[model samples]
Target: MSDPAPDGLMPFQAMEILKRAKAMEATGRTVCHLELGEPGSPPAPKVIEAVTKALPQAQGYTNAKGLAELREGLSAYYSAQHGVSVDPDLILASMGSSAGFILAFHAAFRPGARIAITRPGYPAYVNTLLGLGFGVAEIPLTAANGWRLTGAEIAATHAASPFEGLLFASPANPTGATVDREGLRDIVDTCARLGVRLISDEIYHGLDYRGPSVSALELTRDAVVINSFSKYYCMTGWRIGWMVMPEDLIRRTEILQQNLFISAPTLSQIAATVALGERDYSEEQKAGYAANRGLLHDGLSTLGFALGEPSDGAFYAYAGIAKFSNDSLEFCERMLEEAGVAITPGIDFDRVGGQGYVRLSYAGKRESIELALERMAKALR
Candidate 1:
């Protein structure tokens, strides 16, 4: 038999190409970066100012869960935004949503359990579950369905042998696809019947162009909601994210957080609390991203790209380029060397259809995105 897949499958694909491109650029080559979904805009000035002013007092940790003030602020935000009352006792701060993944996986899934996740989904979901020895139940989504997993699809795949939980992202990464009201409702209903937990990643919730994204907490009280200030608020490097677990999990998670992360950085928590009060700044950034989203969509179509689905939210467009290359990694390497553009290969997201597709990040400024689009247009032609 062939060699088994390795356990520690680090995110080395993009990094490998990046290092190669860096070496080339040092020799006087120009490179356009479209590989990473990093916001070109900096955090709102109000948020930055808050962080600056609070740095002095935020030095010491108050509690492993989070500062009482910060947690209260987050609880109020949930009530205001979702109209769903969240008690301060229910929230826990963490290093990032990525940290939430680790803690949630370990505490909830139990060892060797299975997790239901969509194919061509965030690759980390698969790797993280696998690293924990949890088998993955892939729910392959199609473009016709907006690349979203449905209740019927789940029943088809695992109604008999259901997983312990279901993990999904709204305005999903890489594809930028959003689930409709019906799809979300159906899946939630099915999971209830099968006793599968639901973990919803709402990192891109407020970054949508079509409208504000949906939250899982609205559908069920038992779901785990993960969110961050990195996207809509332009606070990537801050590394602050929150988790809203069921009341029972909250207690377990609080003790878990104490031993695991101690607490999210005290300074970041202070700044995040302040940022929630600065909605004016965040809304301004959202408008800019909305414009960039439209511009990139039109530009990609003009460049002859077949978008997988309408990007209802987030800043990526997963497109097929079968006419160009069957091996996306090779295509990406060639583009980096010839066009001097840094784009992530879809193989990082999907092992099946990935070879015929690639993901483009439009999180940069208008000017840079225009230039990259022009280069892709020329290179693909």
Candidate 2:
């Protein structure tokens, strides 16, 4: 008999909104999609060209850790983008950040080990940990603190009750809070002192607006750094991402990758290799997101949606909807049905405080953001 499914796995609610929006679109109604965090652009031209050219020979299984060339390319990328030198040997390409997370969590912590993650952060982190049978400790971050986690917070929480590891995201999902270099350094130091392993999610690294996103590799080599080509490379459907592991965890992660995912999609990896070289194309995409962010932020604020913290990076705006409704799900549904604009309820990210909040993704084009704003404004009125 199959084992019972883990109770900790939660459905991705934003996908539900997308489904409803698709249903509306099927009925010939135009829906302004601000719900899912998907980029509006396709893979860079050069990336597609490379993949198309390589497709004939790209079908074979690769090294479980991924292709050597891709890993070297990613290593070069880290050096160029973050000024951090990473050894290509330590990099493992995975299906996406989702698979990378599974590998990292499995390699880092044994089942039942306690790991601390921020509340109002990425739901996948909590859900993945719980599904792996790891104990999750929520570290509450508030708007007063810009929704960013500080080293002091980690140290204080560890002092009261120790955990085996900490997982954090800069340019975090749902809430677009990015931690500065100094903050990251302090947190790294705190983790070292407290004997907690650090897993840094840098998937949104290239999508930053305020400033460059900090790499945990810049602070320490001991931390596991996960990144993806999904967001910045505009290749979500390509299903390719990677991780930079410490020397110690390399073999463990390699073994896990071998068993779980043989390697990321071969053609996607080829595309990603070319994508890594397209700095100009990536920057152009980032520019689009920046413009959309500004338009959405101002428009939502004018519509009386209270933003908790300024979204420093990423394409999401976590806004307070308490004035409209305490139930974020209901609020988002009303916005979708009445205004023809789909958004995500914040409850997907934070179970406790999220009922009063909703997350809107501005990862689409300028016209879409503008249209979504207009629709939402009308609905709110």
Candidate 3:
């Protein structure tokens, strides 16, 4: 056997597709990239200026929690943007939401504790929890219900097996389905009643095309909230994010951060502090994403792809491929090799129900979306 694939670890198929697409580009082929969810735009000019200014100073580590100035700014961000008052001390800077997930998983859950996540959810949530030795309970969602996670699902899942935590994302990846405020409140109330710790992944907060995203912090301080500058702020390479820790988990997460990370990158912390003030620039970027979304939606539908609900937020279009092929992976491979287009197989997000689906990211330029759709039409249509 070929090294008996690591137990409980599944490949992130999107990144795997990205790697292959890059190798093809190395051969001087011009591939239209829609596989990864990275912003086509660069960081705001003001953010760059701040980082350049900070570069001359010694970029040493901040304390485990991160720079006080940045945390204070994040506090103000919640107040002004979300209408919530979060204490600066409870906010811990992390190395992207990836690290924030790791920290939150470790600090919040006991060893071998079972955590519930939605099927058709972010792959990392399931993989990370499994890699860390936690039992994963995937609650299945469907297009019939608009791909929503609900209080009934949580309560029913908990009643059957009794998980210790529930981790979910509104404006979720692959689908870009957002839970509205009323729906969110019900889920929050259910989790509280069922004694399940909630972890909210709000990385796509500012990219909501429907309306503003509802922060879990607005409903409960007990939930562990995680966010990053990667998506809406277009700062992926910076590898910086933040977590609002539950009061009980603060000291543990801080101690874990001290040993696990020491601190987030000094330069990124400085950049993020300035990024919070660049909402106008972020909004302009969001408008571009909206146009790209419309382009992708209309193009894919014309090609007979059934996207359940139009993405309300985030920059992804999760489309059903039943009209094209039964195997999403094979379909994606053929698309890449023959059509010179790159997108992710839906099996990366939902192992069971995703074989007939694929996710195309609209986080790239309008030209890329147009090109990919054109190439796909010529090849498939």
Positional deviation of residue 126's Cα in model 3 after best superposition, in angstroms: 1.1
Per-residue error (Å), model 3, residue 250 = 0.7
Query: Candidate 1 clashing pairs?
Result: none
- What is the C-alpha lDDT profile of model 2 across 294-350, one tens digit per residue? 888888888898985459999999998868999988888898899999999988889
Question: How many clashes in each structure?
Answer: 0, 0, 0
Where in model 3 is the C-alpha error above 4 Å?
A: 1-6
* Alpha carbon lDDT at 32, candidate 1: 81
Best by lDDT: 3
| Candidate 2 segments exceeding 4 Å error | 1-6
Candidate 1, 96-173: lDDT as tens digits: 788888777776767898998888788788878887788888888887777877888888778667688888898898
**What order do candidates take by TM-score, descending?**
3, 2, 1
* lDDT of each residue in 93-210, candidate 3, tens digit only: 9999999999998999889999999999888888888888899998999898878899998888888889999998998887899999999999999999999999999999998888
Tell me how candidate 3 scores on lDDT. Answer: 0.92
Using alpha carbons, what is the TM-score of model 2?
0.96
- Alpha-carbon TM-score of each model against the true structure: 0.94, 0.96, 0.98
Clashing pairs in 3: none
- Write out the backbone clash pairs for model 2: none
